[model samples]
Target: MKNIILATTALVATAGVAAADVSISGYARFGATYSDNADDWNTASRLRLQFDVSTETDGGIVFGARQRFQTEENLSTGGATDPNNSNGARFYMSTNGFTLAMGNILGVIEAAPNLYLPTASSGMGLEGNGFYSLAANTSSNGGRFAWTAYDSAGAGAVEGVEVLYSMNGFGAHIHSTEYSYGVGANYTFSGYTVAVAYEEWDAAAPGGQVDGDSILFASIGGTIGAFDVALAYASTEFSGVEADKWSLKGGYDFGTGLTVYGFVASEDVVDESYGIGASYDLGGGVSLEGGITQTDEALDDTIVSLGAFFSF
Candidate 1:
């Protein structure tokens, strides 16, 4: 991420010193993706720019807002598609260790610590290659599942609110929407961390009618001597049926700007899925990445992708 600092400070009668600034950062990737089903390699690419503006009140409170502009190629279709409703905003205020956020709120389930692998992209390949390691994403492997989360695709966005508090090694969040609610907590000790989250959706919720209902996710991940490792599990329920799944992920940093990571997962009904990947940091906020993934969605179905990722 690159920093573009702006403007300066003001003194108020009520509080200490107040500062204001705006920062810009985002990432981009371009590469090729291949799968057995596609029978051909397809060019894939994405670009994103994010603006973050913030000001501190004289009373020691902080207010911030974030917005993004993004365009991405549709690797599955071998073309680009509209991102629909180019604007979605998240706003919040924080003081001490507590924060109150509204508008495009981050879901507690999605914010839980250790829930994602400690990789450059947090999953396989450049675009995450379906992010099957995410226990909340039960649907990608052919199971019924859904959870509340920030809209990353620029789709209008869920009108929601959330509360977040973090201090020391403990963190917690609560999120609510028109038809869904979620809660999660985490704690870190020594070099290890544990986290858990739960979310439920009413029938009227977007995916509730199909796989919403409720979902519980838990994970434990952190540094392990020479390696970083994590394990995650989730249970989802819909209508009268229930299913569960688990995943184990790990990575090793070689101190030479190169990292290797991978995961294996098992799910009820869906069976098994796995992937392995490596990334080389080239300095100047850029990296080269590649991965190979196997899924149970079909017989011998696999994905191979390579790309260069940039942040600025």
Candidate 2:
């Protein structure tokens, strides 16, 4: 009975106060991406508009929904075509410190706020270069990526369920599907936080697709005075094989609208990789960003990009 409260009594307490909220926010970016492997530069761009709707009734209960209409070009192939457009949706009900969500649910591992690098694409360059910095989604290291995430590709969203709870300095989340599930929790204090997450899936059999069987992840991060830093590690097992990856990154703000960040990552199956980036604020919902990432594989892969971002 730790989080027990009568809904009827909550309704009686608020008595006739009904309010609703709606907001639209998104960003657009365009620029050029350069890959050493391609030996040329290509146009990179994306436009995303998010709609959020919420309503609160007499009770202390609130219901909400969110959807994003995103049109993004395929930057990896050096082609500027918006073929993987997305219109995913997520609905939720919340009260106290708990929220229950369904439809295009945010996977536990994917929802960790401080897990990814603080950049325009959460990685490097104009389009994230695949968000290769993350630990759970090991595709960057030639491993299978099977974590549940908010489906943002036009291939249609995955129907799933999740629950997120946060109170004080502690938070927890759980996500589930027909074949996969994950749970995670974090605690924060004095500008520092520690988090751990685990997930498992069973999609193996005769002629079946073998995804991630299990994964364990951990991270510690915070802002220390003028510098923000984080270190993360992940171990995964899939198809009877096990591998691990780790990342270390940091950022600094010069108080003059200019911020710089750098990162290094290593995985058991691949060579070491690193990246450096910077962003400058130009005021009025606009900014300039640029970055270069070097990934070590069979041959050295480098991605570089610069662009302007507009938000509304």
Candidate 3:
């Protein structure tokens, strides 16, 4: 990763000192995972490279773009090129507390604050958020999206616009595609933060009624003593099926470069999930981490994984 950054910088130097600032950074991860359900042990690894370019115009507007390239391997698939993981250029303009972005922009609902849990190993080490599913079909959750433009099944690079504003301890975000729209707001006071968001689709099927979906999410998070805690709830209606989900997560820092976190969430009727994990910072942008996750199944279906992460 360092070599890649150095080479990129050298190439950029040929431009003879441009106004834009360019930087490259990424991470490499390798882990071993065991799943009781599959009754097998597996290995996985991944590498990602990200480039960020930004510049300020004379008009006091900041313009920027972010792009990434990644490669990965899993026990089942070995190694394969995943073009979908590579995002196209996303451009943005920002000033003061307001910012506007377009092209490959995250969906409003998916980008809403406090929607996903924050953890060192991303919920379950190598597995990562095994059961924290959301209703946004445009997200990685694999749900069905009612908006044609925002659907992951569509071809070509995603196109959308998002507007964001933040002032004092308050922030708001709004975004839309051709057939979908969403709004979100968050506020921080004292040591607590609260957020809520809503999103809906406008697709009308042949039956004369709106055939799309809508989602509402709310969350609160704060630091209490040595632990950081959060709770979130979401209600969604997709294709006539309505489901509600709630999750609680917390983390503690030992002040010795070690942190532990855990979460439990339930949705629908029989769905339940939980995970616990810890990470130790080894310094120099490296860490060792491990975790276990159990889904709504028999106790034997749990999954455990351990891994090392490197960032540059």
Model 2 residue 197 distance off true place after TM-score fit, in angstroms = 0.9
Off by over 4 Å in 1: 1-17, 75-81, 140-145, 208-212, 298-300
Give the alpha carbon lDDT tens digit for every residue of 39-88 in model 2.
99888777888889998877667878998777777534222234546556
RMSD of 1: 5.9
Clashes of 3: 0
Every model's Cα RMSD, please? 5.9, 4.2, 8.1
Candidate 1 whole-model C-alpha lDDT, 0 to 1:
0.75
Q: Give the alpha carbon lDDT tens digit for every residue of 1-312 in model 1.
A: 011011112223344547998999989888988877778888888777888998888777887888877777752321213643244788877889988777877788778776677766677887666677777666532322246666655653677888888999899998888878888999999988899898887647654434356778898888877799989998877665676879898999999998999999887857788999999999999999998888756345788888999999
- Per-residue CA lDDT of model 3 for 35-154, tens digit only, reads 787898888677778889998655456668888776666523212234235656677767799877777676656665555556544456654635342323212122322322222211
Clashes of each: 0, 0, 0
Enumerate residue pairs that collide in model 1: none
Local error of candidate 2 at residue 190 (angstroms): 0.5
Q: If scored against the real structure, what TM-score would every candidate get?
A: 0.88, 0.88, 0.80
Task: Point out where model 2 deviates above 4 Å.
Answer: 1-17, 75-84, 139-145, 204-212
